[model samples]
Target: MFFHFILIFLLISNSIQNIFKYNLFHHSHPSEPKKPSNPIVIIPGDAGSRLRANLTGKPSTVHIFCDKTTKDYFDLWLNLELFSPLIIDCWADNMRLEFNVTTGMAQELEVVLPPSRLRTMQRSFTSSALLFPSPKLWGPNETFVITPRKNYSLSNIEDFFTDIEFPQGLEQWKSESPSLIIDPPGVKVYCIYGSEVKTPEQYIWYHNWLFPDYQPYLR
Candidate 1:
């Protein structure tokens, strides 16, 4: 279909821009924590995005999401990798964390800090996220298929997994199995997979597709 052709074209066109690089910084945490708390913004550079995408083999975006017991806010401008790679700097009261995307198909989720705020863990399963070049190119690929690496229930996959909606000319495709990884030292990443490739619009969809680990903020 026209959609699939667009997806392939975009994939081939990913090289249109040169890879970007960025640096990370650290801020001091408050001695005491409070109710409202402070804002936290974590930005990964373009180099980070490519490292993550290569490591996970899925399209990736970078952003910061914050929440309190009563309210939540998403600073779309804080979503750095989607636009460009820049050092996203912010402060917080009690919470401390950093994020990154690594390279290699075998994930290096290293967390050496035992009880400190820094720690890392790993899980094995099959998952996939699709990528489209642009809206003008959205379409379906006839070669798409799902492969299993371990025993599990295919029926349990989220409805979005079965949903593929690209534009007329571009289609999306991916080989499923654990292609996405979030290897922050102390923080756990909430992975959000969407039904199609599109620009970041609704804040809720952003949370759904990107911040799966922060369930408390949603409730």
Candidate 2:
């Protein structure tokens, strides 16, 4: 009877030891940490990011005709009055006429209003009309106009074309360990362009100039 009791006690001790050993091994050798998903950050192409005139307190200045003299012109072009596909076609025809005349101007005055600038202005009008399709969609009261910043400096917008900087905070985020990557990658950036727009090449050129360290995918 004494021998049987001793044997039973030994069996129970060995089972408990085995269970503890298994748990300790698992605790010490956990599964590999999961790789984090990279985050995405989209930076829009020309006139895509909302811009406001610091001087005028107006938003979406990209829609505004920069050199229009009369409110009527602003109403028709900037406010997008009587905006339709047919109207856009007529406007584009008029712009082509204007481009021809402007390109013939003497070199001194051409410096002030370059042919390139005129073409961009023409494209902005037609692109907006096509993208929005309806005046109500591009209306002044729309949240798309109101939700973005009201204090973007005109000079800043101009400067962005030449020297835009990546946010410094994002640089730090990119340095984190691979496992900690979350839903969004540490730094996600997209440069969006329209098929009709010719500015993508210029944008890619400047983007590369600004961020030579990183190679961005341009699609």
Candidate 3:
């Protein structure tokens, strides 16, 4: 009996020593885990097919949001000629909204916009739909390259929904119908319907000058 007890005590002591060594090794020489990349993303807005508009313009801007990663590698550049340093933070915030970065490294950034300064950059999408010659700066639907802020020609609308027409009794057909006409000159009213446009008045509101026959296109 005495010999058996001695053997059991020795076995228990050896097991405890092994466990302590394992914990010590774990604490002293920890494994080096790989780090993750930032979650911020950049999205370019659609620019209209308006070439010769600006010699220099950017098609897309960097929009930074946050993610669960501890890394933050957001280095967004902007056109120095168009906006002041104060506008830099606004661009950053707008990028944040575009990317939908809810948490993580992005949450640390706090961007505050000024009152008058805010209005200066604010533009209504409706007013900007009209194309202008020699515009001061690029607005919506104007091509802007991601890097170096270079200008590029606008591409045609690839989405076919821009010119879609539905059946006569369609739920929203009443507002979707366009009144086509021709004027004294060669200018004909080719109303390309849009999804948001509900009323005929709203469809042709931009070009008030209309022609005779109100021929509606199927789409």
Candidate 4:
């Protein structure tokens, strides 16, 4: 509950700061209401905060080759090169948070502790990894329900429609999708999505070098 309030405060304060900056630089209307001079905290966005991981020690891992410990904190989340082919799993494993029934909290397998529990701030960190902000942390809200889904999933319905054009139809379809059903809207939906970006809809083939068309169905 407290965390949610802090986040809401940050967003509102940052928005006010932007308005003040605009008023400070541009001409204000004669009848315009006075802007508040209150201070503001800058809103942080994706990849804004740096992340580092240090391997304390772990009992064992499924993959014997996976690093069990690191001498110092190393870059964890920010590297795209790690996501190539067979290497992606290792990168993800490093960031995976396991729920602990004993502690009633998630931990990084007691292996990589940075993302799970951030301590000191670092400027030298390579990639800025996201600390999982569990919805439970922000408490409940009546306005909306946010369901966390897999980072990349074969959930795009249009992706399935595109597969009919290819040699393999539904045979190649892969799914870890939450659902395929779409209910008719009962309330206003203010969709905010990227239009120019060509998102992957069909999975013909993928290579690290060649990026594919990215688009979402415009309703």
Best by TM-score: 4
Model 2: CA > 4 A from native: 1-69, 72-93, 98-163, 168-219
Clashing pairs in 4: 198-213, 198-214, 198-215, 199-214, 199-215
Residue-level lDDT of model 1, residues 68-117, one tens digit each, is 22233233232434332212222121122334455434443343434322
Backbone Cα, N, C clashes tallied per candidate: 18, 5, 13, 5
Candidate 4, which segments miss by more than 4 Å at Cα? Answer: 1-49, 108-219
- The predicted structure with the larger lDDT, 1 or 3, is 3
User: Number of the top candidate by lDDT?
Assistant: 4
| Native-structure RMSD, model 4 | 23.3
- Which regions of candidate 1 deviate over 4 angstroms? 1-70, 76-142, 146-163, 169-219
| Winner by lDDT between candidate 4 and candidate 2 | 4
Evaluated against the true structure, the overall lDDT of model 1 is 0.30
Better candidate by TM-score, 1 or 4: 4
Ranking by lDDT: 4, 2, 3, 1
- What are the runs in model 3 whose C-alpha is more than 4 Å off? 1-90, 95-184, 187-190, 200-219
RMSD of 3: 24.7
lDDT of 2 by residue, 61-142 (tens): 2233433232332222322322332334433432232224657853311223334434444334423323221222233232
